[model samples]
Target: MAAKKPWRIIPRPLLETILNNHAQHHRVPQPLLLHGPRGVGKTTLILQRLLPDWNKGPHLTGYVDFAELMKGNLGTSPGPWASWSTCPQPRLSDCRKILEHCVESMVEKGVSAGTITSQQIFTTLNKWHGLTAALRHVLQSKSRASDRASPAALWERAVFAMSRECTTAEVGRILGFGENEKNGLSFEEASYMKESVAALKLAKKIIALQQGWRANAITHMNRTGLFSRTLTHSCTDWPCLLLEFLSQAAEIDHFQPKLVINNIEVLKHATVNSESTVSGPLYHDSLIWRIIALGANERCLPVILVTSDSYYSYEAFLEFGYMEIFISREVSVEGLLG
Candidate 1:
């Protein structure tokens, strides 16, 4: 066969790291960044090169074409959920589609691999009991509430169902949940708690993801995310759980896992909603926060965030504005020839 043309446009070392097993297995990548002008072959390299090889290599990739995700799910211009608030209170509406995509990707990988069993996956998720309860409570509460209820009404129910004061105040106090016996919850605490509670659930399929007829609840369900209530194990969020699942699945073949976010620019593509006017938190919930919390803070999963925008640096993040942080490792896709 003729020599591949991508070899000419891509750097040798980066290409080797992507395609080689020894390099990928040992190297703990810190959210690998590919930033350049729109036509510099970044997406070309991802779609045409790394993706093809990585699938069969000692690594698994959960690729999310976020631009398409936005258009298909939210329309060309998504409202409040698409952007972060200008003040301290972040618009967690940011994580909506991402959560769905992660679950879908997991199901796809599980079905395609056909090597691992639901029991093993269940074992993996069971370790993060808190996430399990969050999903269960979110789903159950939402199920119980009337569909005609307004968003405000639903939020009140979420606070009631998920809050310790509403569920188990004394027990929560023992678990260090309250400020003092005299007070219930400060406004800020109640807000953040409801935010976390509002973030519960990841589609009902999570309870019993099926591959086929032979793969029903009995044999192919990862019910670990629904088996508990109290936060006895690790109290993690959804992204952490998704990344954990990716790591666990890859480890089955002694490989690694990676997150490929194409067109990360879509993250900033928000149509301003009414909440943008309020005094929001200084910082916003970030895609990078999700990755770093798991990659550097917890495990060693590599993430690839591709964007053409020059300003998506250190802390600029995909959606949240202006709180730029540092990404220690970066590679500019430069010197691509005609």
Candidate 2:
């Protein structure tokens, strides 16, 4: 082998295209799809190059790897509905799982990876102190739960460590929040931690209602069906609370938001029908970016570049005669409409 290069190759054209699009587009920039052979440094280029540049810009940035999301179990097993063997439907539960996993990935990797530290994001949340009520509940619940060493547990610990304020009072004591990890977070780190913890807090709430996490909450929320639909985005145009958190954080920072979603191919495993009929020219991924992008203008949203990469990029390009794929997303929000 030639001298093993421990570095990544940035495709200059691709980088320039992404940069120009971000610079030019405002108010709901569409999704850009990347296509190439496997192991061709696509994901590497995104993490090593694209994310660094975006994080440095005036926008907030986050990276979600679908394959990694699929691998993590967020305090629950893959139920029959989500079991990969069944090729389950594209349910909100899967989306909820994804949102949860996305938070985990950001919180765990963001500081080290330096993808979520927008100067504006840091400025917006710098003065936030005290244990937010939602964070208190999440930490208290984790403190009370069994199996204190799972990945979920470790993630909770890490979040607690990152988010500790000056006073390690009652709630902080529950998770040892302010014991040893104070006086170290920079303004950027503090801002990212505030938003990330808030995102995680909201993700937990969504999961509670959407899934059977708390039977009583479901019992009451599902009884009305209206409350259920509102929480789960069944009848609402708003996307997941986590997505909202991302947008709101970026908006507060006054920077446009950019989300790099890798491996759309992994979503094939989570489709509604087990048939080979799902993947085609028209299958707009309704789960994640599509919902956020569609209502961008009406929502008074900043220009959020929600880019994903899959083989569909090439197929859509070939069919639509476009070099890069920027298409709308279509998802069903049918229930609780009454």
Candidate 3:
């Protein structure tokens, strides 16, 4: 065997500052924007130091490298939906991919720490994905059986099946069911389950609409009467749907989830000049804004964005109105050398 490489992580003062603040405040730290030049070890410090430290606690953590996401290596699918010609660039599909990555990371950490069983996470995620897939199948199907029922009726049944499939037992287990002497879930747990189901139902609708858009069948969709004119309106607003899905997932285990994304500068390049009419920073108009809002909201998960671009300046963040959420910080190679 070749010589094994030892893990060597240089400690950074900035990481300590953020951790100390979080420890003292007993809340998620403000979103951090770690910017530096290439080879400054920003990614290394996050992956090797901060992430490991955060994972050691009750807090759940998610790590996404945009570089990896761009290369079609992250999330459940091999590549992003943008790879499909009909799909709008950096649309809801990208948001879904990011959320999937975070949820996967949360599950992995929860399982490894023994706070949650692998079976539970696997079962839950499978059921969730299955429901969405089933809805997609129904919308996309051309078989006579599917044609027998109106798409609206088929969609309602699919949502019902999904709700029924996500039983109290499943939600209970995820919420640490046996921790108390309760026979079943409490009102709050039930409420969360209901919310999760609603979000999933909406996701199915959104996915179906996305597929329709991809197929260039929006004209046909307008005639489907599945959701009336609202379908067209809602389909274009992917960020809201994505936030609902991710927020519920973050709240499931009552774990304070942290989303750490590296190489986020890749987004700047991806959104350089799109046909999207949404205003603000190129990222602010896309899925990134929703992510930032998620972090900013105390009720939702926190986010940490990492970049290696020196040009990602304070003025840009201020202009985007993200300065309040993302405090600028830099990790220098020379500082690490000392």
Candidate 4:
């Protein structure tokens, strides 16, 4: 038998094309769905090679496992529109905390894989601590006797205030800025705790928006007329937050943001459609398409949709011709990342 490779394998040309486009176009076409037979390794490449390196640049990087997201929703079990609930909205501080944890977790993996050093980890942790201190100081200095805001809300205000004080990228970079540009550190070696911290701070504002939308959706659930349309519009716009975050980072880093959506097939399962088609419950997919179209039009971020099965839909993503599909014959995480 031929010597078996260690990682999952993706088409070399497709990978090169993606990297090249990101370097030149400053944006990846949205819904660049990867279609292939089941067990072809599309999802493997996306999760390992693409998402990890994506926004870990000078600004922010985020990943949402669609399959996981879908599994969380009770509606996914009965087919589209069986039932739905607004996904839990996380606060900005909470977001940062999650990011920080992810990065720390990533670093541990990197070290085990011989990708980073102990000193690097400490430096990154210190940066996060410094930001936390700064945010606390800012919040205390601004508090007034009449102020009655909760601690979390006050922290959110302070984060925005901090955002306005420095260039957004600078703030973002502080949260997860790597020395790839000036210090010559590999992305893994760079400090990202700050970026995670910042994400936590930003989560507060995002939660408020989600809360309002959730309320509206619940209110109009009975009346499917104009309410359905309104509901779809609100939900569709949510992904734009990610787009905007990437775009702003591109400006700061002078590199287009590259994004990867892992486990695309799971989305079909995750999307909720209303049982009452006339009232047309919001489609889980509509939001995804909107995200792709907007990303392609803006051309600020390059997006890759990763899937494991060949069942692909053209109706949703035909406008962007830049998509490339890969089929995997062997299963190995090393090959995929390589």
lDDT of each: 0.44, 0.40, 0.46, 0.41
Error of 1 at 211 (Å): 27
- Clash count per candidate: 9, 1, 0, 29
- Badly placed stretches (over 4 Å) of model 1 are 1-23, 26-29, 69-95, 111-236, 252-255, 271-284, 314-338
Task: Tell me the lDDT of candidate 2.
Answer: 0.40
TM-score of each: 0.48, 0.43, 0.50, 0.46
- Tens-digit lDDT track of model 3 for 1-338: 11132223445675556543442222333555655444546667667766776665455666777565344433354433223223223443454457554654454333323333322322333432334444556445333235466434555555444555566655445444563447454676455454444334445454554545444333444345333323333333443443333344453334455666676655554432222222113333344554555456633455566664443443445545754545434332112321
| Candidate 4 clash figure, as a count | 29
Clashing pairs in 3: none
- Residue 124 local lDDT, model 3: 39
RMSD of each: 18.8, 14.6, 12.4, 13.4
- Candidate 4 has its poorest 10 consecutive residues by lDDT at 325-334
CA lDDT for candidate 4 = 0.41
Model 2: per-residue Cα lDDT over 85-203, one tens digit each: 32333443354355456544433333223333323232222222122333345556455434434433434553554455323343233223565655465776555556454334434
Decide which is better by lDDT, 3 or 4. 3
Best by lDDT: 3
> Which candidate tops TM-score?
3
lDDT (10s digit) by residue, model 4, range 134-201? 33445665544225554445555664454444453553354344434454445643334333334333
Model 1 vs. true fold: TM: 0.48
Error of 3 at 121 (Å): 17
Query: Which has the higher TM-score value, candidate number 2 or candidate number 3?
Result: 3
